[model samples]
Target: MMLIDGKKVSTDLKNELKTRVEELKAKAGCVPGLTVIIVGEDPASQVYVRNKAKSCKETGMNSTVIELPAETSQKELLGKIEALNQDPDVHGILVQQPLPSHIEEYAVTMAIDPSKDVDGFHPENVGQMVLGNLDKCFISCTPFGILELLRRYDIETRGKHCVVVGRSNIVGKPMANLMLQKLRETNCTVTVCHSATQNMPELTRQADILIAAIGRANFITREMVKPGAVVIDVGINRIEDPSRKSGFRLAGDVDFDNVAKMTSAITPVPGGVGPMTIAMLLKNTLQSFARSHNL
Candidate 1:
């Protein structure tokens, strides 16, 4: 089985975006800018924001990370979002998830301007995406990244069976919606399985393309995968590994070793969907910039 090298694909996309940003700067006298707001000191959130900021700089885009204390109130955060919404320099705005328990996550998601919602969590954008108005709204990065990988690799999705194993708004839901779009590269019969799914294996084994986003490590085993199917592992779970200095290693939903032997292609964790998500975020930010300036 061949590995779907997302690291390479994402890098190639970034290189293209870097060049576009340069041309945009030359024509519009400004580059696309992304602002990330972090509410707490969650280690994983910090790492994600840092990587996003670093990527923005690498792609020749402007970036700012607003570090807020854990005690920041909902009104205070919403006020900051409103200010960024009106800022012409900021083309994309993203608030890192898992806010303090006292804060309302839904309120924060709705506060951002839909046009600048690069994370694509705003209700307006989500509705537009569900209606297949892709050019008019931002799509969540992970799902967009998955479609990009499939298009780049020339994997056929038309008239195929796509099984998405998850139901979260972030990944699974958007993924199923995108795959079922009546677009050129999309248009698949999608089946979404979650905690309530019955006969999961029987359903999964029928997929031509299987996407695992259930957030469990090594959850999709060989028996659950169909031979020659394309598997996209979106779950990144850290399992304890005594051999590693960090005391853990990253794994995806699919049991890679065993699943790889059965599938025609598979995406590995850490190097797979992770990189693509960042790449798509950059692309979306650039698109937002272009739209704002009529470029």
Candidate 2:
């Protein structure tokens, strides 16, 4: 079985973007600027924000991080978003997820201008994506990254059966839509299974390409996958591993050890979808920058 090396793929994409960013900088006399807002002190969110900032510097882009206290009011956060929205220097704006219980996530999403919403959670961008208007839409990063991986690998999707296990807005939903788009290398019959799905294994066994995004560890077993199928595991869960120094190991939804034996290709947990998400986020930020400058 071939391992889908997301780390290598993401590095290649970032290198390509770095070169383009230099060209844009030389021509426009400015680099792309991205602003990330994080509310509360969620450890995972903090780490993600730090990585994003590092990537911006690597690509010769400008980045800013705004950290608000856990008790910051909704109005206060919205006011900050509005300020960034009007800032010409800031092209992309992202607010990390899982805000404090007191804050309304939907309200925060709507406050950001669609053009600056690099996270692609805004209503306008999501609507545009659903209609297949790629020209104006910024797709959710993880789904966009998955498509890039498939495209780069030259996988055949036309008229094939694509099964997506999970229905979360972030990965599963957008992924299904992207697979169904009538574009080059992406027209497929898409099936989505969620928590309520019955005979789930039956549906999965028919897939030419299987996407596993359910938030559970080792959820997709070998029997559920078709032989020679391409598996994309989008779930990341921490499970106890006493053998490791950290005492926990990261695992994807698919049981990689057993499932890989059944599939022709598959993505591993840590190095699979994680790096791609960041790469796509950087790409979206650059796209937002280009649009801001009318380039």
Candidate 3:
């Protein structure tokens, strides 16, 4: 079985992006800029934001982090988004997810200007994606990362059967749409499954490519995977493990140990889809900059 080394892939992509940014800078007199807004003190979000900021610095892009109190009002947040939207220097705007319950997540996402919606959560960006527009400013990060991984490995998806086991807007839905686009390399016959999907294993076993984004720990076992299938695990669940130094262990939706034996290729937890998400975010940020400048 081939291990899908997302860490190496992400590193390679980042270096490529850095080189591209250098070329763009020499020609355009500026690099891309990404602005991230964090509403609360969620540890995971904080870590992600920090990593993104570091990536921006390494790539010669400008990045800013806007931190707000947990009790920040909805209107206050919207006001901040509006400011970022009007900032010509800011190519991409992203509001970290799982905003405090009192603050409406959709409202904040909608507040972002479509052109600056690097997270691809805005209705306009999502609509453009549905229409298979390559010129769209952004697509959701995780799904975009999955596609990148497949492409970098020269895995042809055209005419293949792909099963996506999730219905989330952030990953599953967009992933299926992307895979089914009428593109030469990505014209897969895609099936999307969710909580209510019947005979889930039976459906999964038929896939030439299976993506698990269900956010459940070790949910997809060897029985669910077809031999020679390419498995992309997008789930990152933190399970308690006192034996570990951090008192927790990261796992994906697929039971990696067992499923890897059954599949021809598979992504491992922690190092799989996780790193690619950030890489894609950087990619989207650069794309947004290019679009904003009509480059």
Q: Which is the leading candidate under lDDT?
A: 1
Model 1 global lDDT (CA atoms, 0 to 1): 0.95
Ranking by lDDT: 1, 2, 3
Task: Report lDDT (Cα) of residue 186, candidate 3.
Answer: 78
Off by over 4 Å in 1: none
**Alpha-carbon TM-score of each model against the true structure:** 0.99, 0.98, 0.98
Residue 205 of model 1, lDDT score:
97
Model 2 residue 116 lDDT score = 90
Model 3 Cα lDDT, one tens digit per residue, 194-275: 9999999999999999999999999999899899999999999999999999999999999998889878888999899899
lDDT against the true structure, per candidate, is 0.95, 0.92, 0.90
Question: Model 2, stretches more than 4 Å misplaced?
Answer: none
Who is ahead in lDDT, 2 or 3? Answer: 2
Better of 2 and 3 by TM-score: 2
- The 10-residue segment of model 3 with minimum total lDDT is 133-142
